[model samples]
Target: MSDINRVAVIGCGTIGMSWASLFLAHGLEVQAYDPAPGREAPLRDFIAVATTSIGRPVPADTTALRWCMELEDAVGNVEFVQENGPDAEDAKRTLLAAIDRLTPAHSVIATSTSSQIRSAITADCRHPERHIVAHPFNPPHLVPLVEILGGADWAVERSTALYRRLGRHPIVMRREMRGHIANRLTSALWREALFILQEGGASVADIDDAVRYGPGLRWAIMGPYLTYHLAGGPGGIRHFLDHLLPGHVKRWAELGTPVLDADLEAKIVQGVLEALGDRSIADCMRARDAMLVALASLSSAADDAQDDLRGDA
Candidate 1:
């Protein structure tokens, strides 16, 4: 019943490969295109690893994946196109314009751009109405959040349904912004984190632990709003605003915006390297994915328990 069955992935980088793996896992035929020479082997390897990490077996049908050298060949017959090209404005604009010209009028083109706004990328395109931003978190196969912005009402609705079918949590923004919603929040926190490191308040490992073992754990279940609603005790969010809002404002004023100068950059690099210790990047990624899987399972179980309690009530 879904309008999207066959998808065209226009880049084979990490994000693109992850999207391909997810599409394949959902039994959708994927046509992939990348200009990099000898990319098929590495892409396949990445897909295999990502599938394992997400605990989804690849479809037995090898025919579901078709590698195309030309951009026109990739988007010719696909119902949806997911563009993972470079984040640069000019490059994305050119790529999107090409896709707009080649793809069918009804086929929606979603860009996996994290920072660039949809309007900017689609500015040169003839069919900007069908173009939209569908930014996914890192390792799209594991993360459920996909931030969607721009597009016509029909296109947005279609994309929402498609993403829901793929078992993704898609948020439709009312308007376009540089970093969308999630990335802006993350950037704010990251700025503060960098400031903390520069001021010698904490090491990289300590800062990471402060998040992972603290708010990050709760964030997996409920966002900051609901978390603070609970913090208001029995009186709820109203009480929270009355008592806690002033303190938050004061703290916000004191928050630092650290510049990533040479010294700070070196400190960060050294700190991260120290944190990694003997583990290679691959090893660290595998470990991170394993932890993510565990956390996802726990979150699911908790949700089910909460639903049961609600039903009993």
Candidate 2:
């Protein structure tokens, strides 16, 4: 429901391209900029492929996409900007400052930073209030969760409405954090996975299988808190705290901190390569996207059924 339709996408990396595809699929005009040469071909290819996986009505022609060579040209008249610059502090600071200066006063600038906080990235900008962090999960075109934080109340409200209109589930954080929310949780799990590998407790394939076939399946529907609350049965979270908290604490205390040394890195690389066997990176990505589309369809149907039941109640 955002009145703003023209959007600017700075940077043409994996994240930037994905954002462009999603924005265009939602019927927004996208002006994209990247310093790298000969990027148009790949960018168009990515958009075409992403549009299919998006499972949404996309523009018939790539005419809605305008490739700009200069930063100012891309954001000059756009109503909204989605920055996908490098994660480095200096690079983001410089890029954001430029965007703030070039874009209109009312335009909201959202960065796709996965780790850095918005405040730090916008510390050098003249209008920090106009900027925010809108970190999307990997393959932004496919993922529905976008973690939003920072910006003034108006900017946050506008960004939230815009993302929702685009069929994205946006979580607006009350406070800024280093890794936002999802990344922090994912990092904790990744650290444990690394430890398990280094300690020879499980193979890479086994860890992936345990997650994909186990808790990961449920996580697709409900988060950890809701899942654990159900585990408590009739008594809810109170029973969980009383009966299971001790074991959880014990496991946490025994969690190992494994460094990514050369040996461990080699093991991880070989394990992943062996797991892939004959599949290339593109092949794996295609497979992953196909499964994501199917899962999203199921989740949508379940949500609709729940809504119908609630109406009946």
Candidate 3:
């Protein structure tokens, strides 16, 4: 992080805008750029309105930020750069090469890339060791997990410190891999859910209910393994593993691979539509986002209290 006070956000799409909002809310000077001509105004406004985390209303003061016309101008003096450009490997390599030429050698470069492996993207950069992957969950300002991978150990430490400064939790990946931990876990769940839906065994809403009213509630506080440990009573993990391992394997085997036939696609669309009847997608997304914002605030406060107690102890 190198005590990052200035950050450059190279793309201003949905994820990019959210990253900019997080930076601004934490009082960082952001220089955002997108080559598209009509983007500056709305992107700036989106960031301005997205600063509700600090309880400061929009249009209060965005004097610190200046949207730039060129990528070079946007990143000229920034201490850190959060790249949210296209996910294509060639495009990322090209942009990173351009950034490597312009940005100071010491500045950390983070990508919001969801799937691309960091090692592959940073291979062409001048300062490959300084380039790290910092993938935040959707609406980066609200969700605290920033999945950091690749780079040197020092780079990960610095990136973690910077995210901490911005009121986020940085989870370091032990290895460089595409789709890191969270996304991999999410994909596993999604794959099974899709399979079930495609087979007409479960509706979209039913799957959501299984999560929202069940595991999701428990997962909010502890992960699956810990939850399972708790479920094992006095015997703990050893007992559960001994008895549950076979059943787990058997159940997983029962879930055969899914093929997306025409009927399945139509069923998926129908189920999704039925679950979201009459509600505009944008409106539904907004509602979900607002809820996440409040949840994140509460979680942060809880974590701070825990930290304080540990310090006292």
Candidate 4:
């Protein structure tokens, strides 16, 4: 039913491993090629952990998955290429150029880049039109939000269709911008959070708790706009705009503009380290991914409100 029966994951990092595992779970032939040596074992190990967490068992000797030493061998015949190369603009352009040269012309090349836009990365590629940013929220096997952007309509549509089949919620950015949509929103929140920390409004852990216990509960179901709309009761967002918007505007004017100096950076680093205390990175990732899987299971395709006259739900 799907045209994407085979996929080539062009990196063996956390993002690539997760993408490969998700593709493999959906019964696609996966040829994974990474520049690093002795990565096959770790990749397979991560996949095992990921699948077991999802309650899906991967076969020991399945020919559906292959490890290739050469990038050419990996991308030569695949229908899709998921590039999770280093986030540097130059490195990404070089890698994508190589993938574009090796992969079939009909194949779609999607970058898992968070910081770089498609135009910058695909600049060196011969067929730039086939490329798109399919940025996933960390640990792609569980977290299903994929921010996709591309020049070609066909490529974007196909990528969207493929992601939908993978049980991912793909949002196509109408225009190109660095950091895409989700990361931009995340950056705005992070900036405010850092400002709060700089001003000593709360301890690092308490700030996290405030979010996790308060607005996060509502955010788990709907975003800030929807929450505000509901806040307006019978009149919706229009009522909120007329009544409560002033308070928010005043608060926004008072929001701190934090500069990340050495001291501020250290404070954040040390604060996070203290908050993390006994938890290992592995422990944190495992737990976070498990929680994400559960949350995603409970999630529906909540409305974006773009078409909302009354409100699209």
Query: lDDT winner among the candidates?
Result: 2
What number of backbone clashes does candidate 4 have, counting pairs of residues 3 or more apart or in separate chains? 0
Model 4: colliding residue pairs: none
Residue 158 displacement in candidate 2 (angstroms): 0.6
Off by over 4 Å in 2: 57-60
- Computed on alpha carbons, the lDDT of every model, listed in order, comes to 0.89, 0.90, 0.84, 0.88
- Per-structure clash totals for the candidates: 0, 0, 1, 0
Please write out the lDDT profile of model 3 over residues 1-313, one tens digit for every residue: 4477889999898899888888887778889998877887787778766786445444555586788988999988987899999988888988888888899888888888888877777778878988888989887877788999858777778789989988788988888667888998998888898888877787988988899999998898788999889877799888889887778989988876678789878888888899888999988877877888778777778889999999999
Candidate 1: which pairs clash?
none
TM-score of 3: 0.94
Q: What TM-score would you give candidate 2 relative to the actual structure?
A: 0.97
lDDT of 2 by residue, 1-313 (tens): 6887899999999999999999999889999999889887888888888987887646546578999989999999988999998998889999999999999898999999887867788988889998989999988888899999868999988999999888889999988778989999999999999999999999998998899999998999999999989999999999999998899999999898898799999999999998889999989999999988888788889999999999999
**In model 3, what are the clashing residue pairs, if there are any?**
1-158
Q: RMSD to the native, candidate 2? A: 1.2
Best-to-worst order by TM-score is 2, 1, 3, 4
Candidate 3, superposed: residue stretches over 4 Å from native: 53-61, 304-313
RMSD (CA, Å), candidate 3 to true, equals 1.9
Q: Give the Å shift of residue 86 in candidate 2.
A: 0.9
Q: Kindly report which residue stretches of model 1 are placed more than 4 angstroms away from their true locations once superposed.
A: 59-61, 311-313
> Total backbone clashes of model 2?
0
lDDT of 1 by residue, 99-187 (tens): 99999998899999888877787998888998889999988888889999868988888888999898788999987777999999999
